[model samples]
Target: MATSPGSDIAFASQKSMPSENLRTKKLPLSEEEVFYMNCRAVYLTVFKSSLENIISKDQLYLALQHAGRNPSQKTIDKYWTPQTAKLNFDDFCVILRKEKPTSKAELLKSFKQLDVNDDGYILHTDLYKFLTKRGEKMTPEEVNTIINLPNINADGKFDYIKFCKLYMTTSGQCLKTALERLQVDSKQRRQQFGSHMEELPARDPSSVLKPSPRILRNSDQETLSNRGDPRASLLSTARKFKASVTCTISMAANGNQNAKLTEPNLKDWPGVQSRGCFFLEDDGETVSHQYRLHMAQRSTVHLTIKPLNLSQVEGKLSPWSSVDTALYILKENEDQVDPQLVCFTDLQHREGFGWTGELTPGLYRLLPSTSGCRLRKERTPEPEEAQLVCRDDAGDLFLTQAFKAALSDVFDVIDLDGNGFLSLEEYNFFELRTSGEKCGEEAWLLCREHFDTKKNELTRQGFMDLHLMEANDREGDPCDLWVTLRAMGYNRALELKEACPFVIDLHAERCKPRLKAVRMEASRGQLEKATCQSVLLQGEARAMDGYENVLVHTRSWDFRITSVIENKSDNKVIIHINNELSKNCVNNRGLNVFAVEVAPQSSMVCQHVMPLNEHQEWVHHCVYSLISS
Candidate 1:
């Protein structure tokens, strides 16, 4: 009996705990069941953050999905009206399990709702965001199971009709093997792709900064605390010779009590620094004041704030040194605003932050706190302006010699009448053509107040000064200046690089000069600057037409200057005219020593110039040239 019992005991198998019919190795699962399980796993993963079995509306928002797409937040709000709405695990399962066979019209309407851009197709990014960031979120792995459908293009995008036919309308029973393959492919792709970690939201820079109390004198602070300033918040102290305010900017209430601002970096700007910028800030909890320096040389600057502390860095801004701030520099010329926000984070051991750039004489603005948000949220703060007025000292040469030389050439090119200054109209015309920006009248007035000018127009010196101010604000970087130079037809060598396409018809009412056959010649000029040639054409005075009669045939930009004459008067007349090359014109191969006399009604052709080299498009750098009589 003992021997038989030992042999039977060795071979006999015990029963499985849960079920006798199920495989011991794994549970028997259908394709739909596995997908539903994946969905449940995602729901659990997202719910883990709340550390609760129950889910709120937002939690549900992160879980709802249909055919790998999530309903919009607006749709969720339409149904889940209560803010404190909750759903248990069973309820969530019921919601996920419920689905109706949608008709073609209903599907089309749904697709139309998602296709807000009406692009006919949905972008991969849009789909991903919809499934993962909208009313209910889904895992990328699960979403990709559908994304790997045969219809998806190399770009991971496709028409909604394809999605409907493949994932929505198709029977789950038929998609078993394909779905299984898709799951495997998606997992392999994810493995090859790298990290699937969701990035945390961007940290607000202002979060690191201790909200500073307003900057004010002791008496002023006390007065402000008692009963706000009777005067406007934006006070003006725009005197030229005023003493600089204390460099130390009093700190606001910072998070770390240990960060003690022992000293200031100093107001070490290049020019005479005068700041009378004033403003105020009131957090919901407390009231304080903020101020920007007034860069007043003349007209007042309107300030605006973008509520957000924009972070230039993408992620992991850690162990930030003491709380820091930055300067936003702006140039206010009426409607012209070039806002620059600069931040020089202090070293770990440094006491405070300072922006130590030198400046030239002109109106400048410093705007801090760029908008951190794409849309305006109630929480983000607006941008504030500080008035910082800096003037050039007696001995300081603001513009470098080379820059001045180049700008002098630029001024001459803009002065169409060969006059010594640029009218606002002329400046705006050139600006619109070259930069696609129009200089507003307010900006013009601002320039007049700050820079040297004659006839209420921009003088050559003033032009140079404006550029100097721009260069200094950028810490002597010549990038912006170079753009203007090139646009104005100047080369790297500061030589005129192109012929001005515009003609300044100064005396057009009487006689107009025009370059005929605007199309460049077959043999283009080899260089950017137009080539010029001159030979004195001897002609006797005779009855002829005036300036309108001269036809300038521009061939290969070979000719730079031509005079047009037309006789508007009934009486025939002989006129004496001068043929001269502008001292400012580039690549001038002609001389100005000849005077030509023409018979009335007869055309007088000055020496026609041709390009020296015959294979490039040349723009005559003569922005303006004059033929005088």
Candidate 2:
């Protein structure tokens, strides 16, 4: 009638009475004999060792098998005899996977969960509430010993959680010993069950293993309990168990295609730089399951980093401080995915800015960028531009796909006059402007003096150049767009996408501010042809690199450059350079080649660099004119 799915079904059946009666019979063995009996049970169950051997010869294999199975000490001694105390204390630890958490906060939380009553004390009722419903109540002495504390706390009440923790750590040895003792009790019960079976009719072997009270009818429980205790003598002869540390190795992928597990001797293993191991859907080759390795002590294992064929790691390495080089392996073939770089909880870790360490002896990962020395400020998340790149849920990079449709639209619209390539006039119309008219007042003001009201048509490369020149004027020739972008490191983006063809539609939308148009008679050889641009802008002036200078607006301002050209006498002279944002300060506009100080016979290239500040605005005009005196 147990409602809970896990409730004891054996206890419910009347036919199981024989097993119940057999289970209740106590064995005559002393506590010590009982303990070794438990050890024997574990050894036999896990490593197939017998009780006689476990009690006499402290075989290492039996101990290893015990540890590997992680059996409780009670289980360990379940089938052991009196003489099996030869196991060391360290050897007992092999049977345990986790040492309880050492952190105080975590321990306290565990205690509170067990202490169901808010009264702050763990009483018998609280203990019942904490343990399984079917668990038997502990005797008064057992409870006191389990929760023994000198001061119990200021309130003089034992904190069950704290007591359990203290007991688990301090009394773990004793508890293990006690569990081993229980093994003897279980054996006595089995014997009583066997005796009761002798009185019943022959049955199947499997049925004998099943619980039935009838099996205990003929068993003399009291006489068995009176038998001379063999546990005491066995405890005296058996060696006391000692605890020791060990390690485990878990491979992320079993049969790798390119990577191989060299001989177990890890001292000479070479680690390669690779993408390492990553989780994937269960495709037989790349298993994504997390493999675990828990070692007895952190220092017992030494991880060595051996450099393989790769130099430093190929990707940015600063962010992954917790990753070690052993977690990575270079790919064997170009067609294959890059060598895998993997990391684990203790197997891989970063100890310093550039240095990482691993504990697994094997060549687990490839060491990447040695130190933070190679990391540039722009490469990492700095205060100025944090979260620059978009990342997906799994931290995979998201690439911006080029707008092919946009490009097609641009080619369709800008290829005006059916020439298949945009002319300066055609480009102006697409930008919402007349071919040969000055921008309206609102647009002109937005543009600095870079826009010339006098000139009607802007030749190609005039759009963004004018905007750059004006923005520079306001900032006192402070770092302009090109210089700032270069310094900020847009070069990396350009390189990653350089191979993709430029989407004309995207260019129309994103590159609007940088384009320009101006009237220039091109050499006859340079006719109409659609081609890629290679304009390189380097100075504070001539901000527009290749496009026509199309000004959205205009404002009167001084434009500066690296150098200025001066004419000794009044004469028409023109100085031209590609990708230069130079303008004359006199009219607060583009330089007038005719009005410059040019002599009738001689001309001068004003080599003095123009000052970008406000105060120096009048110097260029004043210096040459005054010297005429």
Cα lDDT listed for each candidate: 0.34, 0.26
C-alpha RMSD for every candidate = 37.4, 37.3
Summarize candidate 1's per-residue lDDT along 1-629 as a digit string, tens digits. Answer: 00112222121111112223222554456444454444444343334322244445555654543122234444344434454345454444434433222444555556666677887677778767776675435556545544443333347574666544433322231123223333444343232111121122244433321211211111222211101110110010001001111011111222234432232322331122111111111111111111233332332121122112112357532121111222233333556543332222111123222233333334443322211111111232422321122336753336656566656655654554446788886665455434546667766776777678898888888777666665555555455555565444444565442322111110111111121111111111111111111111211122221233332322211122232223333423222222222222222213222222233443333232222222333223211111112
lDDT of 2: 0.26
lDDT of 2 by residue, 457-551 (tens): 33223332443332333332222322222211223232211011111000111111111212212211111000000001111212111111200
Model 1 residue 406 CA deviation (Å) reads: 1.2
What TM-score against the true fold does each predicted structure earn?
Answer: 0.22, 0.18
Give the CA lDDT, 0 to 100, for residue 282 in model 1: 17
Which model scores highest in lDDT? Answer: 1
